[model samples]
Target: MKFKSLLAKPFAAYIYSKIQKEMMHAVADQEAILQNQIKTGCKTVFGRGHRLDDVHTYEEYKQAVPLRDYEQLKPYIEKIKQGKHNILWKGQPLYFAKTSGTTSGIKYIPISKDSVNNHIDTARNALLCYMAETGKHDFADGKMIFLSGSPTLERIGGIPTGRLSGIVNHHVPRYLRTNQLPSIETNCIEDWETKLDQIVAETIGQNMTLISGIPPWVQMYFDRLQAKGGKKIRELFPDFSVLVHGGVNFEPYRPSLMDSIGGAVDTIETYPASEGFIAFQDSREHEGLLLNTNSGIFFEFVPAEEVFDENPTRLSLKEVKTGVNYALILSSNAGLWAYNIGDTVKFVSTEPYRLVVTGRVKHFISAFGEHVIAEEVEQSLMSVAGAEGLRVTEFTVAPRIQVAEGLPHHEWFVEFEEAPQDLSSFSLQVDRQLRKRNIYYDDLLRGNILAPLKLRVVRKNGFIDYMKSVGKLGGQNKVPRLSNDRLIAEELMRFLQ
Candidate 1:
């Protein structure tokens, strides 16, 4: 009865149509966005050194700015941390978005005012797209349970720092904040477990119309809710209509999450990162997420095969074709210039440039040159899990490289809600699926170069225990699904022992 969408719906439809039209000319938009960014930042040190002072066109900008990763930009980032002005972008960053880093430790990504505002606006557009697509407006009348990070922003090198979700929470629209769950006091609870406990206590009886979070944490909340009510979630909250999810691929978690819901609910996936808001679900029936082309981020792609080459071909939006796996690189208003986000994706469409996240640049197994990606492994496991009626709680895979006695094989540490009756068959099915999916894996198996995939059933909540032990309990932290070496495997197994 509280249909507020009479006006909002038309506006959403118009905005979505406008966005679609703009995206058709995505390459042109990307070009202009980058040019403007260069001009605005030309006086900055990064811009000056990268020859942005003279670069006028996309081609010229590309030629001048060599593709670089986080390490190469660290020195400049350090200068910024010391309160330097105009280091990467104009003015000091409003804050730094801290994420996991390799080599030198935590990565501090600069979040300028422009970048933050764009993130806020892009997020709003995502909702508008959803409203235009679904026409489910009743949810707006009730509460929304958003299972994101604690909102207790802390300082990192003089600038406010926090997880992406925490930063986003601070900007939740005034109208929506009225229905948002987890009181501000409860949100500030540092421990994830304690925060969830408090959140459950606060909203267990409320009319939850929407739920949003990463699958694992959201799954935890659902489990606790079901435990409290001893009833199906649908019965507990009949008004719940949508589940917004992202931060990891939803395929592996979809079946289990659907089972938990006990009824139908619309789902929308987003590809928001600490560095930028990239893409979101716009089409109700589409397979891949629609790219946020006109958002304050310029994107480039390098073919996966040529990712490590001395001089890889960097393709603009217009040059990218459907189905080719490419390493996604971003030049954003956040001061990330042609920076690799370590994600690989494949375009599923060209006109509006919709794409699916394929895998991570670093989180893949290839010790034997089988070169298996997270997507392949996940797809294979999900297939087997589906056929055998399995619900995976968590899993991680690693190459069991050269033990004193055993042959080289991939090891899986899996935790499931419903344990398979025959673990051996489950393991065999996973191996067969992998071979079927990846030609290189099939070839390796055929040649007997690699032994069969090994599956080890971890104790219930073993991954939770492990993540906690490693000080990575919550807030956008997920264990890498596939590791190239036995280092993680050994450490994780040792932790179990």
Candidate 2:
């Protein structure tokens, strides 16, 4: 074994033991985090405005701080941006993570000094856990590539600001810096295609062992590398062993990625966002991610169906049940209180609080009163595609309510690496799977309220071109799996094959 890999083993074991102990006491850890946040929050401007001083218990905290999304909390954030102290947290934020907003033009999410470690340390823990569980740490001996945003920052209200990934880039440890690929200048390139080409040039001849990125972008990199070298990724980089991916469901892209690699590689899934690092795949044998309960964040779950109600039912870590879909809410040391992050999850194991991300709260299709989530659509397509030995490149679903002759239906825009010989049959199989998963959709079909979903073949690189056109080609941006309206579908019509 290489010296670095040999050295990592003992440290990995120690970190793994610590993680296990935290999981065993997940509920107690959450309670302690909640109390600490409350005690600190009582001294802030937001706390004073919301009457947080009288709050001593969970119930009182809930009553004191109603759930708020980014827009709802913007006023306080604005105060902090204007250089106010003790407005949200104890002092001015250390940085602002700038992300493209859905409704708001640009969002500046605060990252406080106390909570910044949550982002950096949790990522390290994930890799160590992998090494400890699988006893495969040789990847550290060679180069590691993270296809991420530029490590560039600008000042906003005198606070450093950039994308979350870019901010994390600045904190990569000294040991790993020696093995990290793609020079800083190359990463600083703004355009994705330019940066990707540069990354390929830099790493094509290097001993790349580990790659981390969202699956779609990583797939794009693989395609480009193959085109340039005329060899499978594994042949070009024989040491390549681990793929760390998140941001979207990996199943739909797995077939294409594996084909490009030409062999099996260990993969680790993570649950991370601008707000916090929530979970990571802790064991190869487990079915779901182990929640990060001991981190500087306290989690809450509201039943998915009641999320839009005036007052939804919020359940704590100890109260969550397995198999129920719930919208994730959190209160963190970053000064976000009872904040709904807009993502939904389903707990698979309450014993250790392992959960699977189901979908986004706003990224669903329910125009016909049949709520179809991202997970259902992804599983439907993956099941049918796998059964037929086909590979999909990219896909999205949008409700088609204005049909010319037939009843309204869901329209699936898909780009295929290998097109099915019988498109109609493939579509039927996928539609059947979706119906089997969602009874509301099945009922709508039975009652003739909606027609069976229609499949539209998108030309190769169609999704990529669409994203590029909108200036969201890379760096944490992903196409919504499904939407209630036809905005994306209407735009996709130009790319139809």
Best by TM-score: 2
Q: Compared to the true structure, candidate 1 yields what TM-score?
A: 0.96
Off by over 4 Å in 1: 3-7, 494-497
The local distance difference test score of each candidate is 0.85, 0.92
Error of 2 at 306 (Å): 0.8
Model 2: colliding residue pairs: none
When superposed on Cα atoms, how far off is each prediction in RMSD?
Answer: 1.6, 0.9
For model 1, the run of ten residues with the poorest summed lDDT:
488-497
Expressed as tens digits, the lDDT of each residue in 299-369 for candidate 1 is: 99999878889899998888999999999999988788889888999999987789999988888888888
Candidate 2 regions with alpha-carbon error over 4 angstroms: none
lDDT of 2 by residue, 49-148 (tens): 9888898888888888999999998999898888889988999888899988777789888889988999999999999999999999899899999989
Report the error of model 1 at residue 367, Å. 0.7
- Model 2 residue 270 distance off true place after TM-score fit, in angstroms: 0.8
Q: What lDDT does model 2 reach?
A: 0.92
